[model samples]
Target: MPNGEERPISYASRSLTKAEVNYAQIEKEALGIVFGVRKFHQYLYERRFTLMTDHKPLVKIFGPKTNLPAMAAVRIHRWSVELCAYQYDIQYKRSEDHGNADMLSRLPDGQEQETEEEKVCFSYINDMPVSAADIAKETKKDQTLSKVLQFTLNGWPSHTEDTRLKPYFQRKEEITVDAGVLQWGIRVIIPATFRKQLLNELHENHLGINKTKAIARSYVYWPNLDDDIEAMIKD
Candidate 1:
């Protein structure tokens, strides 16, 4: 204790996927954590890892079963089934106690890599009755909903106007019918990285057809476009 404050001896942490993504470190961490699990479990066919963590929900989930009816039970049950091949003992500690594991959690982003081994192990099915394709199909159907829309690396186009092109389509801030006559709308590139904002626009109903159209044009015309987004827009 620097000032005689008690410091924990165990460690606990969770890794964030969308934060500072450093490719090299991501590669290393990917190997150690994500891939390591796949490979480690592959050969052992049976083992229990002591996971140190301070995340309350994760602790309850990974810890032993309890009689209490909890939502976390669903999550834990799923984890238990998936990790059944290898035993996992979930234990708790102060965040300070779990320094080493926390370091793995803090290991600058991108250290987690996309590995072939993991892809194989984490593949669509094991004992589960459903295939990922089923869920994906549902998602695709949802996107195709007339009110809802779908956009991806491939798709979108053939519904845009010619005289006024909609080069892009993306989720955005919600729309709010303006006080004056400026009826709002939305326009975004099909494959939008700024999905949160785009979704907001839809929920709020702030942006309208015209604005959505303009945003589309801007996205299509952006420099990164490989082919003319305008051409694709009107497709």
Candidate 2:
């Protein structure tokens, strides 16, 4: 209450609801839009939240992209005009951090997380595709997957039987055990004994860093194996 003799009440005392506090609203369908990034930008608009994402296709249709993927270009061009109404900020965050946000976005249309209705302008910036050739390069010392890839490039090696080992193979050739085998034009063919050993290596070698490398190496050294490591990497 205010009296003639008392100072008028200030807006600082007023409380804000979800809708009242937000002016901009945004969403990223894929894991590309991360939480820390989302939250940080949300803090910027003060009364609004603008969405940003990595799924170039979706981002272009939803927000602004300066120099981004093609899908991003189309959307941002359209969104820029809509964004003239308010000031918004865009930022990036890693995928793992956005786990919660990604999960919430996938809910069926009727079940979207309850958020105050916000004016959204879908747009994106566009640019050339990333040059994977440099980063995805293969080297001789790559070993395992790399070696297996080189072996394939050189063509499949001949297999011969020896009594020393029932199959004379170091690893098993299970279809399911390998990733993207069909794409590489190679399928592992080996005895059950080889399978058991490979399985043991997979289970026993618990270190997370080189699991792919070891499995790939086993494939390279094993019997009747075919597939390019580069293809596997792409797949």
Best by TM-score: 1
CA lDDT of every candidate: 0.34, 0.32
Alpha-carbon TM-score of each model against the true structure: 0.28, 0.22
Candidate 1 residue-wise lDDT, 129-168, digit = tens: 3333442333334323212222222233446443222322
Which candidate comes out best when scored by lDDT? 1
Minimum summed lDDT over a 10-residue window in model 2 is located at 121-130
> 1-235, model 2: which lDDT tens digit per residue?
2553423221111222332222111222222233223334444344565555533333443344444333222223334444534454454545654443543344333322423222221110011121112112322223343433333333223553543223322221111112112111122323322333444344454544345455645332343222333223334
Compute the lDDT of residue 19 as modeled in candidate 2: 28
Residue 175 Cα positional deviation in candidate 2, in Å, after optimal superposition: 36
Candidate 2 structure, TM-score to reference: 0.22
Worst 10 residues of 1 by lDDT: 175-184
